[model samples]
Target: MTTLMEKAHAGVVTSEIKRVAASEEVNAETVRKLLADGFLVIPKNINSKSEPIGIGKLMRTKINANVGTSRDNVDIETEVEKARTAEKYGADTIMDLSTGGDLDLIRRRIMDAVSIPVGSVPIYQAAGESIGNMSSDDMFNAVRKHANDGIDFVTVHAGVTQSSFERLKRSDRILDVVSRGGAFTISWMKHNCMENPFYSEYDYLLEMAREYELTLSLGDGMRPGCINDASDRAKFEEFIILGELVKRAREAGVQTLVEGPGHVPIDEIGLSVTAMKHLTGNAPLYLLGPLVTDIAPGYDHITAAMGGAVAGMHGADFLCMTTPSEHLALPDVADIREGTIVTRIAAHAADLTKEGVREKAREADRRMAVARRELNWNRQFGCAIDSEKAKMIHARSRNADTCSMCGELCSIKMMREVMKK
Candidate 1:
């Protein structure tokens, strides 16, 4: 089975490259080169009906909205709606992290609901029999199942091995492990008295990936759970391992994306990003919030957006949306919408600073600036990321042209008059 990366390396630009090139506004050669070098990835499974999305170098920093059913809350329809809602609100992709209610059905329904690429954590399902009962086969089986179901990418916490576990024990971490998949892998290893199957038998995983043309997302299993635990030895240890795994995957022609730390302070984000990129040879860096702070539980979405923008500026290629209910409960459709839009804003904000795509991103801002300056409400709405919301908020104003905040005292309006002279 020839994978896209292998094809690219062989100097064959497939249709996927052509489509992504047109969408990202880069020439097909650029995408091909980046994919061949393992610096970018297009996570399209052979069976996936979803349109291809290019992630990594020279592409717009993308947003992923996670929709899934919790054990306490299992509504297939709701989960599917959440997926659609996220896509409608500008999420670049969706990850079905469901741990409840007929996982296969929930996963398939979510995929059918959206045209964007879908991703998942296979170990979550493997742990359905409880952590203690999961055999190594269970883990691999779940991965193969999801891949067969057209999961474009899968987050395999292959870094959480016996070696990394030793480092974690040496480190004095407060939250210890916040990643459920990481916790599961560690627990299973401790119980079975063997190394993580994903690591010990990584060649097998790579074989399956190549067979399915799957993109491996090297999960940051030991990622910092809070700012206090940010960039610790354990985290870096995992990065080192993931870096090795990334090279192995590339050699096998299986495209890969490296996931980064979830909770990091604003000051240290650059360091975390740089280290991960360096260690992993700059494989497409997919990041969870890297939420700057842990105290704002309810407004974690905003907290994450603040951190996401900074992380993107520092070379994060993808930002996973965090909702207001992030630290609370299963997010509904409304939460998904809010989170997707907020994360998209952060991605766009970062694009304004990123290379290769900055000028194109800036041109969009220029259009909005001109619209605002001319007080073209309709044009301004047209340029908005969420024109419906913009129009709604603008409709609240007593003045027809300017918004309620400044009204007739609007700076743009005043500036327009000033410029006329």
Candidate 2:
């Protein structure tokens, strides 16, 4: 019944650690040490059977795709397809954020559909069921339900306490709180005139997490909703609380990750990422868009990728994909695929600068370069992250060896002929 952290602490390398180590190209003992030190987290609940992934220092930057139903749209099959698409397109994890339909059924269906780790936000269900009148028991029950349904991780806004709320009240934020779960927690606390149950009863929460071996993703409920609100006191106060919660979770042998900002200006991303890493004692940092700008409504995925690449370079361990439909509407399957691929690109871009995986990342680019030099269309497509797209684009040209852009005037072909002489 020992948790993975507990086993790691005892110097016992579990099969999960071995798998993660092998996947990460690190020694099993190294994975064990990192887990024991709370630097890496493998968020596989005991009841869930999925491929283990390592997220933290020395590991490849990971990407997460969110697929779920909203109040206006409730189709379990569509959400399941989104989950499958996310996994097929290389998402490291899938989070079921359904607020409509049977949340339990939707969550279990997503878990059944994908082999990657699945996560959820329990407060959404708590608020959905009670309409903001949820008691502490209602919140705890939602978390327990998710764990029992084999969700590998759950986002708990344990850091959004009354003190953090007071800080928010005193602060000047443009858009205020943008996180749905955060707003739910705040509304519930205000209605009941009580401290956040998750914060006040953290020990109980940790105990349940240990029992299920579920990873706790400390949700950033006070994350800035706009670039103007970035780096405010409320956000930092919640971060400080999350940092302490992380220490407690580690002490209790529960795996943990700290969620980060919603929106931030481009220049502040590095500081935001490093500050979160430092505050949480290097617990694997999971981040939402941290969207650098608010202007690109139709292309927030691009903006988020830009921010994600910078955040990863600065030590963010995990990224949540932001779809093109962000701030607009619920994303369709195509949007999910596009977002997942773009986020993967961002993660790989950052991995090229990271320590352990830089060489591996560079090898792909090297192969692409060599392929381009030889004008090997097949090989070039093979080296591409989206080979189908590459092949499609290449097929547009009438000439097989050279693309339409340059035809016989291709620079690589010219350079090759000169070099051969």
Clashing pairs in 2: none
- The 10-residue segment of model 2 with minimum total lDDT is 126-135
lDDT of 2 by residue, 117-235 (tens): 99999988988666566789989999999999889999999999999999999998878899999989889889889999999999999989998999999999999989889999999
Worst 10 residues of 1 by lDDT: 412-421
RMSD of 1: 1.0
Q: lDDT of each prediction vs. the true structure?
A: 0.93, 0.93
How far is each candidate from the true structure, as Cα RMSD in Å?
1.0, 0.9
For candidate 2, give the lDDT.
Answer: 0.93
- Over 1-421, each residue of candidate 1 has an lDDT whose tens digit, in order, gives 8889999999999999999999999999999999999988999999899899899999999999999998999999999999999999999899999998999999999999999999999999999968998999999999999999999999999999888999999999998899989999999999989999999999999999998889999998898888889999999999999999999999999999999878999999898898889999999999988899999988889989998999899899999999999879989888998999889999999999999889999999999999988889999989999899998978889897778897778988887788895
Backbone clashes for every candidate come to: 1, 0
| N/CA/C clash count, model 1 | 1
Which portions of model 1 miss their true places by more than 4 Å?
A: none
Error of 1 at 310 (Å): 1.1
